[model samples]
Target: MFSADTEQWARDTFHHSELGDRRRSKRLVQLASSLANHLGQSLVQSLKSPADIEAAYRFTRNQAIDPQAIAEAGFAATVENTKHYECLLALEDTTSLEFSHSTVRGDMGHTTSNNYSRGMFAHSVLLFAPHEQHVVGLIEQERWTRNIKDYGKSQNHAKRPYLEKESYKCERASRAMETRLGEGMSKIISVCDREADLIEYLAYKTSNQQRFVVRSMQSRCILESEDKLYQYSASLTDAGMRTVQVRQKGGRKARRAVCEVRYAPITVKVPSNKKGEPVELYYVGCQEREQEKGLNWHILTSEPVRSKEEAERILDYYEKRWLIEEFHKAWKSGGTQVENLRMQSKENLERMVVILAFIAVRLHQLRYLGLNKEEAEKQSCEMILSPQSWKILWSKQEKRKPPKKAPSLYWAYINLGKLAGWYDSKRNGRVGWERLWEGWFILQTILEGYLLAKSLDL
Candidate 1:
């Protein structure tokens, strides 16, 4: 109806449009509200001027969102989003974006931000829901006085390094999910790669403390059985079944029974390479057993893994992490250059990460809506949106190309939008309806005459 009222929809989506300098300017909010009203889905002119965006921030934050509403919406959305992806929830910790506004190193060191010409840093977290093939949470975080370190290298078998900033961000996302957990929601199994071996993660899981499916690093995880944490263990076997998980890139993921070991409980100590030698620490309820040749199934849990099938299931869940890796590819590209954003000041960079995260979440909603067979039939609590609402929320699609780290789901919405009202061809070069009709007829005539004139080009 009337092109789906895009301008109003965009305005409403962003709680407020508080572009800083434009507090008094009337067009700031209008322009911010007009993003969805722009040319195409996978395209947009990022509001560069701080004055324009500060107003947008205030407009959203100051709009009087009830804490209760956010909490309720959070729970509802979790339930709705997870309804379909019941088996696995992929945990992702990657540098979705990084940029250093300054070449000089300070606290966070050089960053991988888009606007590196400015002193800024960009990093993000994305929760990939594999069953639905859409991002569950696309969160962004920024930092100033950056000391971002690359702790990917390990000196000993026990060290693990984690960014303090990322810890907080992951927790925030986890808390947001926790507040909504078990409120008629499907069970979720989170899978992460090596970097997530941090104590904060252990703490994060213990805090809300739901059962999760996680992977172990080659050197970082110290398996503990009877007070002694063992390092360099391969595969797990118990509970009347034999299974194997190989991480060193086996040619194929042959899931048949490979080998087995009499698994025992142990605390997997994560080694930290900073300030000293490898330190050994252990969390309770992790076990080790046997499986295939290279597959090390070190089961870390609050409770003993009950069966081999359960153990296989955990590794199976961890495999889902690859999906999040794929998502990072789309999100960091094209129109959504959340990673490419170069910030002059660190504060602005941080804000950009937060905003990008917010953007990712909305994009995820649209993608999920487009994929669901029963999108029209299903509804998520205020947190999760229905396909009907997706039509309104799908405002962020790109027309020409997918952005790096951009989700294909955005295209789904854009295609749907085209059906609704958005057109790809330029609505230009024609003065009016008569001109448009005449041009169309002229094109037809030219095609018809092309048999001779077009071929000869005389």
Candidate 2:
């Protein structure tokens, strides 16, 4: 069962969204809490009763529930929260939400493999607290289903307007942020991968006085000559060396890669088709000095890098971009299982996507909160876990005696991880998101039984 406090928080977070009738917005909060509590469960299981399921369908089908309005409400809350922090990194990226099986009443986009799939491409700006290294949540998101007829059109050597191209998704995402938060804030830096290295986007950001760090994708002419980007960057001496952690992919273990960092200012010639003048930008490059094939990142930023520390700082912001991808993982399969939603219309699915996306960020936050032992010890477990949850975990995991006060949240998470099959050996390391959530769901189930028993005694 969902706790009253959790339900109230959901309502408060979504209160700004005007979904036709006020009652509809309230229903949305109730439905969202249910979805979050029963992560990976189908809508029927999450809603529990037949009456609630029917109501959910009605809410979903309502044309009044605009995805953009609801998204803006969430974004407003994020902006308000960011007012307290001096610096926030707005990590932007795009991900495809596949609903290939659903015969929704609208056209869908092509998946990464160019397969015919029914889905929406979401270009989003995920906010992060730079110093704390915690994901603050998404502040902006733009969704679109591709018009398949336009697919091979860009391949032809044509001088199409930037708005006519599909790559405009990055520009739209950045513009949405600027529209909401304005320019010259100095507190926020937009971060993106190589896909966002367009001169037009960089020029727009600069014109609007917005800070950004985008990994370079194009090797266009630079410095009023034919100097290639790679050759020009290679000529510059190394600024410094740093060890960075790289995530594992395709059966490889996570490891650190040592790389030398270099930075230089370059002027990229504007594409003749576009109206913008030459865009002068700084390039920060990192090359791995290790095995045959490893990590190499060439970044372009609006922020000037005068020293190694400043360049590393920009790279650090880019590192936070991975958090947004992890947010997608948590949204898709890891936690909320958004793709399982069976709504039959594009409008309905988009509404649910907005709600689930925020919930996924919260779930990711929960998994990260209790990981740090030192910080967790200084805080009360009740801040995250309920009293019953910590007590039950302490009793079951410790086996002999329960502590007078609840165990620290970190210890509780450790026990929760153990419940999910993690061994106590040091080599086993800390709990991961997959196992931690597995234990969390199991605990919620056991807590339902414990509550039932208490009610019987009463």
Give residue 376's lDDT in candidate 2 (0 to 100): 68
TM-score on alpha carbons, each prediction:
0.48, 0.91
The TM-score that candidate 2 achieves is: 0.91
Q: Model 1 off-target regions past 4 Å? A: 1-90, 100-109, 112-134, 138-190, 218-304, 339-344, 361-458
Displacement of residue 377 (Cα, Å) in model 1 is 16
Candidate 2 residues 1-458, lDDT tens each? 11224576576667787767888878888887787677677778877689999998888888877888788778877776777677888887888888855576255666555656668788878888888756677788888887766665546625677777667878787777767776425788888988888777888888877888899887777864566888778788899898888886569888899999998888888877677788888888988967768888889898888888889988888887778887787888777878777777788888888888888877777666665577767766676678877777777777766667766767866777887787757563467666776777777777778998999995
Candidate 1 structure quality by residue, lDDT tens digits, 1-458? 00234344333333243333334224432543343222212112434367756655543344342323322322243355455555536365555344433522232344344223223323343455554455555322223334345333233433333544444455555555555555422355545555555555655565454545544444454444333333334343334434434332238653444544334445544345433223232221133234334444444443344555545545555555654543443344422345555444334344434434333344334434544535423433222322333333333233343332323333443344343344546442112212222222232233335545757886
What TM-score would you give candidate 1 relative to the actual structure? 0.48
Strongest candidate by lDDT: 2
**Cα lDDT, all candidates:** 0.40, 0.77
Candidate 2 local Cα displacement, residue 26, angstroms: 1.1
- Alpha-carbon deviation at 437 in model 1, angstroms: 31
